[model samples]
Target: MAYSDIQKTEFNRVTENLIEITWTYVNLLEEFPRLDEQDSMSWKQMFVAWANEFEELYGHTNWIESEKTYPEAVEEFAKEKILQWAGIRKYICVGKHIEGITLNPYEWLLEKGQDVKLFESEAEAKIYLKTNGYTDEDMEFLKFEEVWH
Candidate 1:
C-alpha cells in the first residue's frame, strides 16, 4: 500500500512548513542579535520574541505554544508526522519466475500463518533467503517491493 494522494500532499505541505519555519528561525537569529542572548531574556520572553518574529515574517500566527512552546511543538509535530508516515511502510520479497517457478519467499513464510519476517532492504532479504537454502540463482529472482498503507 502506498500513500494516498491527499496524504502525500499533506506530508509535502508539513515538510515544507517545517523547512520554512527552520529558515525563519535562522533568519531571525541572523537579523536580530538580541534574540540569541540567553542572559538578557527568560525562556518565555525568548519564545514570545520567536513567535513574534515568526508572525512578522510569515504573517501567520501559531497557537501550538499554548500547550508546549513553539519550538517544542514544532519539533514534536514534525517528529510525530514523520513517524506516522514512516509507520505505514511495509516491505516484502516478491519472487519472479526464473527457474520455471515463481518462488515467493515471503509467501512461503506467510503461508503458515505465523509471524512472517519483513525485510527493510533488498540486501537484507537476499541475505536471509540465501542463508536459508536459497541459492544465488534463486536470489536473482527476488525483488523487494515496498508497500505503504
Candidate 2:
C-alpha cells in the first residue's frame, strides 16, 4: 500500500511523539556520579534497562506488540466464552465451521418421563438419601445410569 506525503508525515509525527521521551543520567556507566551537568538518553535506553529484567521481554514487548494487533485473537477467545455462557453453540470451532447441535440429556430424560437424580459421585447420593431418611431397602429397585456430559 502506498501512503501519501501528508499521511506519512502525520504518521511519523504520531510515532515520533509516542516514544519521544528523555532520561536524565549523571553518569550512565557509574552508579552515582556527581557532575556539573546531567546527560540525557532516549526512550530506547529506558526500554533496554527494563528489558534486562527478563530474557523474552524485549522481543515480545518491542517486536510483537508494535507489529501486530490482538483484536482477532481477542475476538476468537471471546467467542468461545460467549458460547459457553449461552450454554449452546451453532458452530463447534473457531474456524472451518462444523455444525453444533446441542442437546441436554437431563431435559431429554425429563421429556421421556424418566426420573433423573444427578449426583456427581456415589458418596454424594448416599449423603443425600441418608439425610432424606431413605432406608437401605428403599434403595432397592432403583437403577443407576452413567451419563456423560
Q: Alpha-carbon error at 99 in model 1, in Å?
A: 8.2
**Model 1: residues with Cα > 4 Å off, grouped in runs:** 1-86, 97-111, 114-116
Clash pairs, model 2 backbone: none
Instruction: Tell me, by lDDT, which candidate is best.
Output: 1
How many backbone clashes are present in model 1? 1
Q: Which 10-residue span in candidate 1 carries the lowest summed lDDT?
A: 77-86
Which segments of model 2 are wrong by more than 4 Å? Answer: 1-115
> lDDT per model, in order?
0.50, 0.35
The digit string of per-residue lDDT tens for model 2 on 52-72 reads 322232224443555443333
Native-to-model Cα distance after best TM-score fit, residue 18 in candidate 2, in Å: 57
After TM-score superposition, the amount by which residue 88's alpha carbon in candidate 2 deviates from its true location, in angstroms, is 14
The clash tally of candidate 2 reads 0
lDDT of 2: 0.35
TM-score of each: 0.33, 0.23
